[model samples]
Target: MTISPQDLLAAASHSKAWPFQEAQRLAKRLPEGKPGGVLFETGYGPSGLPHIGTFQEVLRTSLVRRAYEVLTGGVATRLVAFSDDLDGLRKVPGNVPNQAMLAEHLGKPLSRIPDPFEKYESFAAHNNAMLRDFLDRFGFDYEFVSSSDCYNSGRFDDALRAVLANFQAILDIMLPTLGEERRRTYSPIMPISPTTGAVLQVPVEVVDAAQGIIRFTDADGSVVQQSALGGMAKCQWKVDWAMRWVALGVDYEMYGKDLTDSGIQSGKIARVLGGNKPEGLIYELFLDAKGEKISKTKGNGLSIEQWLTYGSEESLGFYIFANPKSAKQLHAGVIPKAVDDYWQFRAAIPGQDVDKRLGNPVWHLLRANARHEGADAPGQGETLPVPFSLLLNLVGVLGASATREAVWSYLGNYVADADPAAHPALDALVDKALAYNRDFVAPTLAKRAPAGGEVAALRALDAALAAADPATSAEDLQTIVYEIGKQPEFGFESLRDWFKALYETLLGSEQGPRMGSFIALYGIEPTRRLIAEALARA
Candidate 1:
């Protein structure tokens, strides 16, 4: 069945995948004579490490494709992730290896640079391969295209000719629009001299299609020769952008807000190309964390690996899904809240305003969660640590007997000291419970286990627990330990030393959270069992 604009709107409202209005407009503008389909494109310049921001753009496009498919009853939609490997290296990022190599590879294809890590054949190949692997791992079914391949294949010849034809038109328009100063130096393309940073602004002599050559005179009217790369051959960046959309049949594209003027210029070029301007163009703002834009060039980008280390895949997904198309700063800490908000929205949406625009934040979170839910690590739910330290302690106190029911029982009776209420807080608790199950249940410690002295201290604590009255509550036991600790020979200092030693022996660490609380949570039996096992190993 063909998807209608209404269907897209409904899907956007329910799924919050993209801006509802934008989706609606795109759906309405879909070619009427053709069978229903959509093409979304996101491009990446593989000049450096593929940071989380790269994933954000590509994944967002993928989400839009998925949304279209779902709305169109599984009709195929294409998502293209273009790697601009032919782009010149303007600057060497600090993290890149062999910074000096950039000088040799300055104007050459990025794929020609030797891989600094020696993992891939070239620097460009290494970054592109890693990015491709990451996208594949995340289940983004994108068609990967290398700029070098496109150029060599001559797929952009017509678009290139169009660009050259409109060179004077672009110049006239740009002069009036961007002002006279820019017009004086601007050519339709940026043809920089290898010897100097001067622009070559003379009339073209020949456009040699067979030889892929373009001969032009220099500003001083000196003859100069340059080879044209085929794909949209040798056009200015803005003109080239418009040509890309027309040549590639792009239906939707997004750009960062920083490129607003370029996007506007691209739109103008689209009119010149006689191709349909994209149905919608989204402008996304930079994502900042703690007052810093997450940028690789600025050494402020957060790596995806680091994020996965601390957060669940779902949490990461939620961050992207909840953000808006508008220009606004964002922080990483906002991710958990986005996840929480998405879950709440999913729960609330069945009866809410059916036609209302779901807030961008809510939509972003839901889409992100949906996308990540499929590829997440197995047993993730069982591995996530509980959010509250007290909850973890409580889980430990319940020990091997810990279950959802047991946890509620302890929290109701001892911890919160209140009867459980059927509210959002309870839902939060359930979420924490699931996270704990995913992250902490199957603890994998490093090879170097706790030390012998630490194990002895844990054994002493276990012996003390065994000798204590069973009828005495956990609080009473703490009181007894405190009283024993007050003795001059076994003072608070000794207790601190003992706990530190125990941590080293039991967990192979110098420190951990509260010991008495930890023992109480793991339950007396499990704590003793773990201690004994650790002591034996030590």
Candidate 2:
């Protein structure tokens, strides 16, 4: 166990974990008035049900917060999962019901539009509730802030005044980025129509910075003097983003790589507003299997619900935690490997050294629930007793109707630590694996007839397993199987072909777990029966 408490932070400072690296970058601009003080912010647009990308931002930010806490020896920090719910609803989300109702309310703030689901006061409320529910379910520590709440309650009053005061400067920063047509009508100040209540994009006729008001022609061609502060108006997207940083005193925030230009402009605007822009990272967006950027409007990305349905949430966390700066292919096909990688990392943590453990993904992944600061410690994380892929294969072997008790019986044979009561996490995985198999795996399975020397090779494997002790370890049993596959009589040219044949013949998949491990867990007798059944296929 590493007991050098004094050197823990110093050692972690050099560690290469992305979260630690991010924390290290953020360390320079530590907030004032308190030791280790900082505020981390993540923005959410309440336009659709929260997608994995939205969840990824929060999850990744939380990891950085954990790393910062470890690096600074318990720096006080706040994470605001801010919702930009006051933004106008430009289009109807296909996933939601009553599309016509949403279409009618286009150009209104999301918070003002009635919920198509009819569960909350507005569409934004319904979506924000889903966001909160998901965040709460994960036990993430964050304060949920609403844009409409901030604006309607005058919380953004000072920021609006700052923007009004520096209107030309912000416009100077934002105007050049627009095209010829948009630049003709664009104004930093967007007045909420007093008559229709829709957010208006009309050009401002006057900016009375001293009065916190802007005069603009409303959509009905009526001259209107609107209070730019409060809920009376909201700034355009880029201006509002910068104003938010100014208003909230955000120390660090993260955004998608697509917003690189926007971040630059927003940072400049924030500076013009007499507020320092927060330290931030621009992460790559999640892409679909087709390599297209996952778009909520295109309705192409996997929803949070779909991920949770097939894989454990922790597995999804594991997938998102790795390589934030790099775009990842988000699809159902990637689920099994992600599920396995999560457990694999967790299981490997205990065997690693202090520096290695600090860099290990599982350490950062579970540090939010860590008992103490140091890396070396017991009860640090929950590890799956078996690989999620194994469970998927287990479901295939046991059939769709297999229950927890039946699977646990086989699970007990594979790992002595397997316990339904002690490891509810693993128990949950079993259910997900079963569902994934039923929905995805079973339909793709194609058991083929064994031919030529392959038949002889299978017979030899059955004979060898039948003669060996049923209690043999996976490693030893693997060697026994390997030796049989290499016997020149089988006519096998490469080990790859042999293993592929095993996966196809036994599991009906392109690849599988270590044959020894599969065989050991499957029992020596059942594997022989499986070979017999394969051999019996004409």
Candidate 3:
């Protein structure tokens, strides 16, 4: 596991990935021979059901943690997947099972709200279970920390004392960010109401930092005193974030772009509380394809379950890995491109330098499965098969089948002479593509017409392909396809557009596999007949 410092430095300087750069900065920030392992944190708000955005934060932070491990010679690292379920329910969500029941519990901590779904003891417990289930399904390694547990078990008591002692300093850092009315009512600690059991946000009447207690005016006009330790009281979120950094000894954490101000305020509060702030990264939020923000409240984006249905989990990981800070679209349509990109990256891994190989998203995605836990070193992971997008197209072309063996037989015709079991990853992709095509791809199939010049080009390509041998080498067949696109009759500005026309007319989509390999595998005569039929209909 030991890596040379030079190797770590090379990763920092040569890689363009954000996680790598963040890890490099982290390594330098820590003093030489620091005693404790690095702690990476991602927080979830359990106000409603868990969603894809929640997964994105953990995945991004975990990637950075993995990169850090590589940089520091397998240095000890821990990722704390913390959930802020202790926070009060601000509003009733439109999507949960029983809206009326949730509405009645507004202002109560999520942990105290009864589960409308009847599956768990409380709403928070149900959501937390969803989080753990999905993460475990992806084989993510981490310790789950519930804010309620940290508070109720007295684990946050020491940090609570620190916040109480520096109450004014923390308030000073936060008040300017609030309007005058909020500033007047704001207190860094809110007591759990003894009567209604809601988290009372009323003004604090007195603070006894010396005794670790606070007195606050409740919403119903009673003055109540509660110990800051245990479940009696909890720090406000900004203060809580800083306290968690100190109590958990977190080294790095990330938040959404919207939390820029909160991060700044938390860092200042952490400094005042006698702890250094964890290094923070802010990622741009996901947007829907229509360019509107993807929000849990709006229910605008695809869910984790939906994403998994249309695409492999590794594809979703690649989508997140690409431009981590850029605002990317989270849609079902993006899944195919993600799958193709994963294959491309996996294909490039052989004989690559350490830095170049780590740049591949597959390298990070592989660690999601326990089987590939220690496969982090350079040139690791099994080779992938032909792009899943291609298999999906092939599935569409081959029509419905009674069994998967028929589909594998079609694939063997293209790959030529090699047993697919020799490539387990590709074999798995074939199974996935079959199911994905039947469920998602088949229902969308439609006939497409050729454009102005495409008709003649299709005609010529069809004739040439009819005469070409199916046993032709992939390289030679590929050259023939390229040459057909170059014909003046096509007037294509690029070879890509010509290929796009072929895919549209043949597969009912504008994207598919390499024409040479596809034609050779699918049988050139059948392709010629397919093209000629389309021409006749046009």
In terms of lDDT, which candidate is strongest? 2
Task: Mark the regions of model 2 whose C-alpha exceeds 4 Å error after superposition.
Answer: 31-36, 98-100, 369-377, 381-383, 417-419
In the range 234-326, model 3's lDDT, one tens digit per residue, is 789899999999998989998899999889889999899899888868889989989899866677889988887777777888898887778
Off by over 4 Å in 3: 1-16, 31-33, 367-371, 376-381, 398-406, 416-424, 427-462, 485-501
Off by over 4 Å in 1: 1-20, 31-37, 119-121, 176-182, 190-213, 217-222, 225-233, 287-298, 326-332, 335-538
The TM-score, computed over Cα atoms with residue i paired to residue i, of candidate 2 is 0.93
User: What tens digits encode model 1's per-residue C-alpha lDDT throughout 166-253?
Assistant: 6667666566666666655566654544344233443453366445456665555566677654432345567767878888888888
Report the C-alpha lDDT of model 2 over 335-368, residue by residue, as the tens digit: 9998888888777777777788787777777765
Candidate 1, residue 372: CA error in Å? 7.8
Q: What Cα-based lDDT does every candidate model obtain?
A: 0.58, 0.84, 0.80
